[model samples]
Target: FVHYIAKEMTALPVGARVRIEGLVKAKEHNAKRGTVSRASAPEGRVGVKLDDGGAVLAVRPENLERIDDGRGGTRGKGGEGSNQAGESSSLPPPKKKPSSLEPKQRTLKRDNAILREFDGSPDPNLLVLYYHFRDNAFDCFNSSEYHAQMIRYYESGLSVRLVVPRKIGNNDYFLVGLRHSREDKNALCEVAFNCKRSFSGISMLVKQRCFVCHRAGAPHCSGGCRCACYCPGGCEERGRTDHGRLCRLVRESDVTVEEECMQLL
Candidate 1:
């Protein structure tokens, strides 16, 4: 992995006119022309300030192509002396990426624990909590932070009514009245401000059921997303098409395995 980066990277000189090329993580940066702002940054990458804006981005030299006279010309020499026009561009590409070495993995154990804990058996009141916050699973799943804070508010046990609204992002937080009181207000405000995810959502109730038939505590999980469950019989097959939609979205989600484990409980 280190060899691939070392072989491809050619440091760009400060003030060198270059065009951002190659697959930048943020798609918008590709093909954007920029001048080398700093010859080097903290990391072993060149820093370029975009021609359109003042934001300096640290990019690997391999992702940049040199512009000869401010106009698109030969491929960048990466400041390695000089090269013929298209000399660097002519080489066959190698199939290597930082992400390739560490592939994504599912968090089944945590998912199972969450589903079996809070979202316990189809209680009439709890409903499908997972569905409510499926879109922002990461945010709402951090309720643990809120729990600890609330306990500390009274410095002992305090009687308080609960309002677990399905919708967040609105200013309708239940603690607004006490958002400004000293010692009292700040604690509430701090809890609200620090924990924005109210997070937000996607937790499994204690009693999990197959998304297909709602069979209590379905034994099987959809292998693709590992989020939904299935009954022991042909339930997995029966819900293939319907579940596929959500499955693909979950698989594509950029959430890390660590985040998933934290969301448990």
Candidate 2:
């Protein structure tokens, strides 16, 4: 029934197995200061600092009984590896395996609903579902859960991309910094818009055409009658009354259309 403070513990429930390899002594006192501070106190205070800059108070010595001194001999009155009376075991429960059709059946049911929402013509290749669990850093690129999810998706014969961007600047949204180039930005927007349309039952074709037209630098101009001509770089420049004529000139001339599109001029 021995217990000691561990520095690695964080948000763990009580009665969890915490390994500490050291001796326990009486709590130290600070003689120089009038009032003793926990940080300035010694190790015997039964407190530990976590990795996330947090501290946890350990179980009191009265509730703990030392079985081993971390050396060859036993420091307590009892011999090594002896537990006190009524001390419960700290071992975790054994894990069980899922049935062969358990996971696949669950996924199939969810996919059926997704397909029904898409009028039964949904592209299975474009579908991706993620189930994340608590207890890990989202900032790291290669966490154990992340890698395991990737492997599961890959083994299912699906072509998918898993993106977990770290918090940067003051933006709360992810991928704000990764989409620096116009092409990259457009790709992200297209994915987001398509996902929205698929889930909300909205028409994305009109939106897609509008995006293309905007990129081409042509105003709506009452449907098909565009006021601006088709330019290679799209609708970038503004405030010109004769945008149509300017677009025609750019199209006919050899001046490389740069400055806006992701490709070279």
Candidate 3:
């Protein structure tokens, strides 16, 4: 944001002790110039001490150019004695910092959209497609047909169902499914995680009430699989089919989420 003024540039190297300029009759007038007192001058010039005068004088790079190096050579713009024989090497480039704000903001926007479109469906498949579309904007979901398909799925409410996998650190989590009726072929609503519960093994604590009925009670785990939790009173029975499929996947997964984050396509 600060613009450096090129007109104020000075050739003298600041902080170097140097002899005063001029004074042809002075004893050190022909001697090597003293070190420059400072790099910058008050009036947009460089500060240097004369060999004989020893007083600071504001001068431009051109003024110092007249100073002989005693070997019939002149001082360079950078400074006197900068290079032994006018040979110089460029400095190393500066380092750049990588930024993560752009991607994070994009993810935040996508999450907000998901929460808005969510209709209490436990399906994770639709979410996968949604994220896929977002990450790969050039992919299939952006098309009119795909958009319609996604809209339809979002509007399906409790009828549509899909399984999703989430990796948190080294642990993997699947959304808990719930069924409310014996005739229900799949779970409709996802069980919410209890944030207050103690975190054990990348644990996602189940909501105190049933994921389906919202009943107030302790939850029951289905088939010993940690992925599905329900009310033993009856919600567990309704989710048996849908939750069974998820449980089977979790059982068969040879790699734990703790090992690596997987893209569940």
Candidate 4:
């Protein structure tokens, strides 16, 4: 029931293609974000039919990013259209990308940066961590609910598995970071502690470095077995390669670590 400022927004055309960030379910009209889908309403509050034929949703215009611009020209957010004068028609800004001259992907970067606040061990500076609560722990939570909660914590970007970890005391708790492979493989990393309340009381983590690169910022694990970190970007190769050598480590230690991670939050 929110009304957008008429001057700042316009209806999208039917058949226009838009890309939402995550997965959107059919029953959710207010799903804040999702992937490519077709618009059913062009001007009013954005409603789209997901490409998968799974569900239809009425999304906020701001949440609907036009990938096709509907005029056949591929214009990204901060594209040259604005410079053309008189092209200032109402269409959501193009898909955001990182650039100084263009609209920046602030949301994407912010989500990736959430891990920066956690000062625990296992190297908090490694890769970006996106947490996901699953199965029974998330039974009552729908995609819309999940998306809303995530926005409260992180923005939006590459999704990773965030496992609920064990609690040591009233204040200390850890989260498990997982990376998935295309072949259904999973890697596990034991994240350092973040205070359950204000995140101000992190317990000292003994494993402060990545098992792979042996540098700080060890924010990843190998399939729920062992935790190791790779330096950002060019260093990922070493992280994965090193994990292969320790594939047996998870099997050996999982009796304690893996079971804790797999348990319901």
Candidate 5:
């Protein structure tokens, strides 16, 4: 019984509001209400970011129970305090419909990115290419996982659809200087390839360069597509041949790229 309790971790989705239940070692936080801030984790533990203090707790599922959320929505858990800790509730079964943030919606985007994969055709340097992946851990975003996804992007070479969010570790972290140059991939023998990983996404992309004339740092971008670069007069005119066709297609794709963080000013 003790061993069973030791390894049991409930599969609560992230953002599921919970009330801390039974705990021995850390009894100070008992009865506190918090949301299941992290539903996905490497340690198979739950991360509850408290509403009162805002400190995230790594507790077992047995210690957290889904609550009424107080916002009309059960957060997909159940109604009015749902089940007791570790005991299935008699409350109406939790909603089955997936939320927008769920993996289902994101799978389509990832699929489209794969189908429309492009490696900048004539010259890889000029045009912009967005890297994408399905699953991501918090540390992996900046650490080894970042590189792995970059390599995956290089191999797949998708340019149409943008990447979507995955589970980040239990923190509000930021990854800068994310270039598409190189990053670490999953190691067979747990390899060590620690080099700076370059990132280029919708939020922060490399400087635009003239796609047609092969010139660095171009002034104009194809209005509709917004990926291809062009110089002022002659260069823009020169690249028109290739950019013309791509411009129409990208506009037709209608894929909107969103920035990760909002501008303060």
Candidate 6:
């Protein structure tokens, strides 16, 4: 019969302290007895070998001792060497928990007065215009200047809307509400008035309508009317006869003065 020992128990050093109070089992072994002319073998129990062959049961933990010389004293059972040290020395400190009020402090504050004025308006068109300008603070003119211009236009009975798409380029911003008509829309009117005052040159591209009229033998009608050239019949000939008939027709029509002026331009 042979006794067994655990693998961990066999790993302990010879002098290491341990508590091993447990039952002991017997073991058997065989050996040669005499060596003579005719040798005889003897068979009997010798000692016990633990299941872990590297360890012997004959040695017990009680026989161990602390060996101290110049080095540090040897550790006893469940001593400092059993638990490794210096593991977490370089680890960082735990982070602090964030406060709930921190988010509220960081939130941005909007101008409530402007918001309220826009909110109180009943017209959906007005609200849409407000959002368009409000969202594009950098692209649109400054809010103060835009509001002042809007008030002035409103008081002038123009009922005009500043319609600009969100992604309109900088050059296009000045042309909003003006490009649709070649006449008195704000952009065109501003440009024409500036040109007349010699504040800016009337470039050929900007005065394309005038150039077309001149090329079509209607030079005198350049600034007067677009219909003089753009009307149903092509402008191929120059004549007082066609001119007088167009003038009479324009005067008799029921179109508004503003629309009539645009047609003329």
lDDT of 5 by residue, 1-265 (tens): 0111111134366666667754657778987988776775556668888888789888766455555545322333442345544344666755777543322111111122221222123343313332333333101122123324433443443333332111112211111221122222211110000001112222212223455565644554546455455677887776676556555644555354533321110
Q: Which lDDT tens digits does candidate 6 get at residues 1-265?
A: 1111121112334333222221223213111111111111133111223323434344322111112222222333443344344232344436757653221111111233443343344332221222232353312222233334434443453333221111111111111131112222222122222111111111100111211232222232432322222222343233334444443433343322221011101
> What's model 1's TM-score?
0.26
Better of 1 and 3 by lDDT: 1
C-alpha RMSD between model 6 and the true structure = 41.1
TM-score, model 6 to reference: 0.15
* Clashes found in each candidate (C-alpha, N, C closer than 3 A): 18, 3, 20, 21, 9, 2
After superposition, which runs of candidate 1 have C-alpha atoms over 4 Å from their true positions?
1-127, 130-207, 258-265
Better of 5 and 6 by TM-score: 5
Best candidate, TM-score: 5
Candidate 3 residue-wise lDDT, 1-265, digit = tens: 1111111123234543333322224425433455456676675556666665666655543223222234232245555445555654364335646553211111111122332233233333222122223353211121233324433433443112223233323323343222212222221111111111111111221223344454434353556545445688577777665565545544543322221112111
Task: Sort every candidate by TM-score, greatest first.
Answer: 5, 1, 3, 4, 2, 6
Clash pairs detected, candidate 2: 216-234, 216-235, 217-235
**lDDT score for residue 173 of model 2:** 14
Judging by lDDT, tell me the better candidate of 2 and 6: 6
lDDT for each residue of candidate 2 in 83-145, tens digit (9 for 90 to 100): 464343354445657553221111001122332333222232212222122531111221222
Q: How well does each candidate superpose onto the true structure, as a TM-score?
A: 0.26, 0.16, 0.25, 0.20, 0.33, 0.15
Minimum summed lDDT over a 10-residue window in model 6 is located at 196-205
The total of clashing pairs for model 6 equals 2
